[model samples]
Target: METYDKIGINYNKTRKVDQRIASIIEENLQPKGINLKLLDVGAGTGNYSNFFSSKGYNVTALEPSEIMLAQASHNNNIKWIKGSAEDIDIQDNFFDGVFSVLASHHFNNLQLAISEINRTLKSKHFAVIFNADPSLVSKKSWLFDYFEIVFEKAISKYINIESFKSLIQSTANTHVKIIDYPLPDNLTDNFFASGWKKPSLYLDQTFISGISPLASLETNTLNLIQERLENDLKNGTWNNKYGQILEENHFDDGYRFLIWQKP
Candidate 1:
């Protein structure tokens, strides 16, 4: 069974598509052409796939977990396929473009996945939205203070941005243009770092369960983190150290858009 099959029960509740991020995805892929044939790799819950389909693009939503795909919206415009990125069943050069959001870390083999992406993509460009290495970002995030183990696990899983770019270029002969995506205070999609400003959201199991690192934690660790955070918030210790972040409307919590295009 896929990992999400166990942990993704409440995924759609909090993992809704943020329009700001969706608009950026649309804008970047727009140049490909109207009604282009697109593929959404690792299409969790099909949020972005449904978004693109609603915009008139013919989208093929590929996912490995049946549980995740089961939650996808019923859309005639999307053809949902059960598959992994390392071995896409599609034919060579089958898609006009492809995109994946916050799903690459779950891939069993990054190199095979990139090769498969390149093999199936006929167009010059594809987009991926991934987090910066947790090691670097954790230093600036209060989340590390509360859930140190979560960040430690994430650091082992997330690829370094520079190394990721190099891997893509080597595998696909594509140029990578990275754009920084700062988290908005009112971000609708409650991703892992989305609670940078509103720390209380992390205390909610429903909210944190949607995030892989947090969801993967043992019950004892989760309880300990919660207890510490609750204590800090009650005693103003959290505010004392990280309260200044509340003044900012947006934070560069190390989310980035990596646009890979053939030069």
Candidate 2:
């Protein structure tokens, strides 16, 4: 919860759900009715909730981080419940659809979340969840593969698509139809996790928000990490193994979005 209050400050930075990805999610994860009662787990900062609420659907935001819920309350539009997906106190079969983005990896009790998801939704209900590349625990990216060694040493393990299947499905038949929305870039282990440092124009607070997903690190800690990364970039240690990237923008990693339905 503490992390979110701090993390929520920069939550919208590099992480707006790409409309390209959102379009696919919207197409497949659509509710059955116009005024559908929807649930958004890990609704950080209310960006996505606000987006859906704009369209006239009732969106209930369930976020574990109290700080995030506070920030999300900036808009008085949605129902903000301070709870994780696993421990959601709402009633059974309470929603037509449920969705969350970039917050799946932070789940402490993933199985509980899955069980809760199943318990809360009636038959025919759907839940959509999206998270970043688990293997991409490093800082380097297609734009900045040079920093991989540095970042790889400093990151933690992330959740993958297969883990979603194991966590959510009790039976083989009641499964999540996984759709991995990979970034439209190199998939090899050579690319960086954070991507190149962005073009000169993109290096402002925008960079702070849109750059790193390092939500756990404080500002000072983040600075130390960046300081080392900059040192590596300058000393040419990064470029020796990974060459300077010609292009800086436009990347799409196979960051998966698992779409589950109950019959």
Q: Judged by TM-score, which candidate is best? A: 1
Q: In candidate 1, how many Å is residue 68 off? A: 0.9
Each prediction's whole-model lDDT (CA)? 0.82, 0.61
| TM-score for each model | 0.95, 0.75
* lDDT per residue (tens digit) for residues 1-263 in model 2: 65566656655544454455555656666667667777878777677787778767788888887656655644545888888876988888888887877666667777777777767776787778776654543334533243343344333556556765666666323777777554543222112233433322222444454333444446675666566556766787656645555343434444677788866
TM-score of 2: 0.75
Per-residue accuracy of model 1 over 1-263 as CA lDDT, tens digit each: 35698767999989988888888876775445566888898898999898888888899999999889778887789999999999999998778778888888888999899889888887565655554666567475687777778778887888977788889989888788787888898888888888888999988988987887788788888898899999999999999999998998887766887778643
lDDT of 2 at 31: 69
The total number of steric clashes, by the backbone 3 Å criterion, in model 1 comes to 0
Model 1 — which ten-residue stretch has the worst lDDT?
A: 127-136
lDDT of 2 at 145: 46
